[model samples]
Target: MEDEHKELYIKEKFNNIDYMMLKSITDCIYEAVCVIDEYGIVIVWNKSAEKLYNIAYEKIIGQNIEDFFDDAMVNNVRKTGVSIENKCHCPLKNHPVLANSMPLYIRNVFRGAVSTDRDFEELSRLYSELENANSKLIFLENQVKKNLGIFGNIIGKSSSIVKKIDMARQIAPTNSSVMITGESGTGKEVFAKGIHELSGRKGLFVPVNCSAIPSELFESEFFGYCSGAFTGANRKGKIGIFELANEGTVFLDEIGDMPLSMQAKLLRVLQEREIIRVGGEKSIKLNLRVISATNKSLQEMVKTNKFREDLYYRLNVVEINLPPLRDRKEDIPLFIDHFIKEFSEKNSKNIIKIHGEVMNILNQYKWPGNIRELMNVIEHIVVTNKNGIIQKNSIPEYILLHMKENEFFKEYPLDLTRAIRELEIENIKKALKITKNNKSKAAKLLNIPRGTLYHKIDEYKIKKL
Candidate 1:
């Protein structure tokens, strides 16, 4: 009797709760919804269901869910009385969606089931966009390829610099060994990287200073080693520069300073294209391009018996001689402009320009240490100043002293006209030096027009460096 009373109470309560109102609410919502009776016939098909399935609500309301949806969860809920919550569904081909279906009860007996669905196309689109954004972030994280320009960060427009880049590009596609001869600070590694970038190789660029590696460990450093190769070795073994740069470039900097014994070992690797680890029995093949660089002359070293003749010739198959900073003085002004801007932004300084006298002094100075020295000087200058222009007083003491000692004003004629001509020649030289032999820039620095400067050059027979 009590069970019968309880069943009657539940039926009354369900009748009182208007399902029509519930259907109206679900139709206004954007998510798709469908409700069915215990016999698996659809009772409530909301407006969202019509949009999702592209079928009218009136048309699907009386239809069995099994007939339209190829057996939806409504029939299973009636038999098992278990909720099938948040299951993936595909009612139609090529249309994936998420669905939640649960058994409805009245008086603790399964009466019906209701389901809500979410579209999958929107979700997939969002996921794809997120992946694309992540890829862009990673590219930016690598410095946009070191902020490289057409010439791979080799900054200069001088004839000498242009010629060097043209030659490097020409040789980049070939597999022949290249040896770059230049001063210690003349950007040999920069050219090496540029060549590798142009080569389209699929591996990293590996650089090492042969002089810095101790003679005792040269073999292990260049040819790698096996596990437990020596008393103190990495337990997992290590890959050498040659192996690390497989299918890429291996830059051997300061190669001229390598010990005689190491030179012989390196030559064997180059000739055979294989290397045996320090203690390993098996030999590893290498498909790598070797680019050697040094300030010293390997030919002269071979003549003096400091370097092996065969090794020298092997590395010099296609030689590139990078002119010294003193010889390519026209590029100095270009370098100065680039480095000053670079260091100013790096140091968070507001320095706009250098004093005219400072520019003139820098023009006259001979940079024995090359671009590396110039970069250091600009970094210091930017860091020391708070704002405004860089004055002559801020120039380093050593540079100023060197400039004073190297002044060339006293070697001119004493006659009035000749002295005037000499002074004019000196000023013209200073302007040309400050502008890096750029006629337009020199004219601007000398406070004259380009036409006037050109006429004067012709009249005075002035030679621009």
Candidate 2:
């Protein structure tokens, strides 16, 4: 009799709760919640459910959920008296969701089932938004490329490069001889090409390597030989580099390597604005621009009598020097981006993002070979990258090892004594921070005496944060 009274009391208290209370509670949830009777008729539907399925409560309350959704989990749960959790389901033909359904039982008898569903379209919407953003970014980048004009191929925007570009543009229209001086792989040839493009010359740009030419053949090569004048010469008499470059630009690379004997002849040709073919008396008039590049200092070579002083002045009438990659760390990222895009398209890769840590490591490196080495490294990374993202591990092993070897003095100068001092000061500050500015604990952490730590702190001028 007491047990019966307890059951009656429990049933009475639950019966007091009504549909309005359940509606209020379920409507507050963000997910779609629906309840169905054991007969498969929809008994309750929250506002979220209505929005998710585009169905109203009045329309669905008495209707069978199976009529609307052939694969409704609630119907299965109601019939089987089992629960389904975290299953992907498609109720409407096109609408998909992740749903959970559980059987409801009272007094040891199955009554109904309830299911809650989270929308899958939300994630799809977010992915669409990201793709749109990427498209816009690519468009803006293309516009920036278009605005760069002929200088677009010459990538760096650092103050050193920008100033040089401006100077090149200003000197391009003039016919004065130009001498380009820089270390090898500093992009001297590309800069020369940019100048030639800006010069608006009608004739083709001719490139001659002074170091590659044989001393014996230099005269015949510069001044085309008459037919039958030299053995193995073209029968019709080949056009020389200068004659081929008439009304255009002549790029003389490694000009310091020109033999001293040929230097005087070249100076005479430049001075007289004419050249006589080998074994031919008639002089051919010339009209062209001279641009010479050399890794060696022509001044030093002139002082040593290796290079003619007159030829040096003729070539060095206007000089432009390119800075190496190590001096312009600010431009490394720009080069990395440009090279990655170039090599990715060439190799049919869709490389989209670079890992932040990879950028940091690349920026910290000192490129001994300048832009050329950096471009090669980026090509290797992109070609070997299996995923769309460029990770730190994708970097070449040599660069990673070099970075690790130099990790200790990354922020300090290469001077050993000064680097040691800077490292010591940095550690002292870290110890202080860890100890909450307590000198005793800080010294103990650093394995030094408290008095010594205090003296070192004062000496290094470290203060509490």
Candidate 3:
């Protein structure tokens, strides 16, 4: 009987040990586990629960479960008395966590609850990363819009100018050579600079004037000469313009005037993607975009043998033709206003008003020099004229000469009987010349309505200058 009792006691002890082992395994696997009794007093707590709540089991074992949770959570668990699972974010804790709880039951009667949670730090990190990525996307979108519109150093509101700007932005990112053809004083360089700014290149913009450079120094200037390359050559080898413009844009202005020899060399560079300096045998690799501009017609020059046909073809991969001031006469008033404000500020003058007769005279004459000449005339008037207004007499002598000789003003008599008519005709011609034959702009400068200017232009039979 004694042996049997001992055996029974040993068997019972073994069963208790097995049960404790199972409990330990469950506690280790659970993330954050806690249990409460019928009175909502804490009964069990695991290692994860202790780490999450920062409270040890030994200290909180018979404590009320409501002590650790918010009032809302305690009320929810008590009222529901059913299993609950949800996600919650706590800014004060700086964490987002998943919470799960189930009601404890004894013989179908609800007792208290068991709860568990997992840290949401990783989820929060992912959300933060997504937000940052979205912000960057928004910034890039805005930048693209600016590049496509007037924000990217292009300031014209006219539809034609806007279309040209859009085209430039689209082409700027490419590696193709672009040929920009426009009359002198039409802001070709401005357009070229805009292209460079949009290209995302980190190199400098090197501008070379084909007409300005002396023919004798063409080889040395374009492809740097080594020491002793010639009598006047520098002692130390100099880098050529092509070399300086590497990894950047090289703007060749007035390309129509480039010498035949230089044209051949430029063609070789374009084809071979390399350049050899004067008096040097070694070739240097080039990675650059070529942008050439000319007021002269390259096709005509090529036919006449003044410009090389092959070189013209190579550089004409992408062509951008800027409209002449006369073609886009609508922009005249805008340009005048812009220039007036600019020059007025520079000279510290308040010459804001341009008399009607003066503007009419400016509109009638032809502008051979285009916008550049117009700007110069405005500056001259602002400097010479006083009383904050520009009158007919203040107009320069050259403009008056052109207007007086104009055929349209010949029919009107210069006598006292037709003095007003003659004076109006003369002033209108002068204004035409000053404003580059832009009627609306000339009218604005003359302070007259566009409709009236049109009537005068027709009545005078303004021989289109």
TM-scores for the candidates: 0.57, 0.56, 0.53
Using TM-score, give the best candidate's number. Answer: 1
Error of 1 at 258 (Å): 0.8
Clashes of each: 0, 0, 16
lDDT of each: 0.78, 0.82, 0.73
What digit string (tens of lDDT, one per residue) describes model 3 on residues 1-465?
A: 244553354345334456346447647865777666556666566788777667886666566666766542433565677677765734125445667777877567776677677666654446535643454456447646643222225546667677778888999998889999888976777788789879987665777789898888887887887768888777665677787677888899999888898788789888998888788887888888899999999999988998888899899999998876666556667666676776788789897688877767666556677667777887888888678888888888898888766653344555775877777777888789888899888898878998999898899888655
195-280, model 2: which lDDT tens digit per residue?
89899998656778899999898888887666678888766455566766778788999999999998998899899988887867
Question: Which 10-residue window of candidate 1 scores lowest in summed lDDT?
Answer: 143-152
Ranking by TM-score: 1, 2, 3
Q: What's model 2's TM-score? A: 0.56
Ranking by lDDT: 2, 1, 3
lDDT of 1 by residue, 37-60 (tens): 777767677898889889896566
Error of 2 at 252 (Å): 0.9
- How much lDDT does candidate 3 score? 0.73
Judging by lDDT against the true structure, name the best candidate. 2
Q: TM-score of predicted model 1?
A: 0.57
